[model samples]
Target: MLRTIAMGVLVGSAILLTLIVFRKKLGWAWLSLFGTHLILAALGIYIVNFSGLLTEIYIPLNPATIGAVTVLGLPGVIMLLGLKITLF
Candidate 1:
């Protein structure tokens, strides 16, 4: 059952990727939206790090944290900060 579900998800993702790549308008829209989101995510982290100088608390700029922020945007940064507060 798990394998079947994974395969279905994989196939669906592949289909979506193909559609995005082939559709010109969709491709542009996808690029612009995600590009903006990635920029916002990086900026959010940068702001936090900059302010950290005063607070002495900040999220480390590692690949894992960066990737999480890049993929999930502002919410990802918030979630990471929350995790740091609760766990560390």
Candidate 2:
């Protein structure tokens, strides 16, 4: 699980870094994406690294995490799509 998460994060960071590097050409839309990524990344890092606190605040292995991930992931996905759409 940890290894999987690590691989996912590595891939995500690489993608985000690409966006960040191209933000100048991407323009204002990239700013929105950067903000969304920041929020989701921070929240995800905290939740994954501090599962005990998250479990205490919410529930362990519950739908809330899944829901949050889904919601948060959408923006990043949109950003990636936007990057592709704009660049391609």
Candidate 3:
């Protein structure tokens, strides 16, 4: 709960800073970062409430397996998304 929100905030801030640093040249990157953060935040909530979404199949991948994994994996996904959007 608290951990996920804190981490999301921190990760979001970092992404925001990166976007600011590359404001003019990386508009696409910024948008992707924003999307990735959104995903992370969603995943965080999903994880924290796993018992509730156990049967949801609307999304292909259920990112919220457990708290620790969700907390750690979100940043990885975000980084991958960022890299994919920025590099290729």
Candidate 4:
């Protein structure tokens, strides 16, 4: 139930943001935002690895991971961590 709610909220927010971006004719701004989010996500993963919290697990840097984090922001990172915990 909680996961479903979270996903619903995430999806709604993404749609809202997309609409706002499109309405303002700021398509390029979305690209910049995505780039920023990707960098933040990469930094977040790096920090997590460096901190040694999940010593035996590592999140790889790749397109799928980047895209998820870019689109969903911090919640996406939390989701990734949750998956890591559950899967491994």
Highest TM-score against the true fold, candidate: 4
lDDT of 3 by residue, 1-88 (tens): 9999999999999999888778757557766766676576667545534646334322224444333234456664444444445665
- Top lDDT: which candidate number? 4
TM-score of 3: 0.31
**lDDT per residue, candidate 1, 1-88, as tens digits?**
9999999999999999888789755556777887887778778888987875537558888778888998887889888888887898
**What lDDT would each prediction earn against the true structure?**
0.82, 0.58, 0.56, 0.83
TM-score of each: 0.59, 0.29, 0.31, 0.61
User: Which pairs, if any, clash in model 2?
Assistant: none
Rank by TM-score, highest first. Answer: 4, 1, 3, 2
Q: Worst ten-residue run, lDDT, model 4? A: 26-35
lDDT order, best first, reads 4, 1, 2, 3
Runs in model 1 deviating more than 4 A are: 1-20, 23-25, 52-54
Worst 10 residues of 1 by lDDT: 49-58
Could you tell me the lDDT of residue 29 within candidate 3? 75
Q: Give the Cα error of residue 88 in candidate 3, in Å.
A: 46
- Which residue pairs collide in model 4, if any? none
Question: Candidate 2: what lDDT?
Answer: 0.58
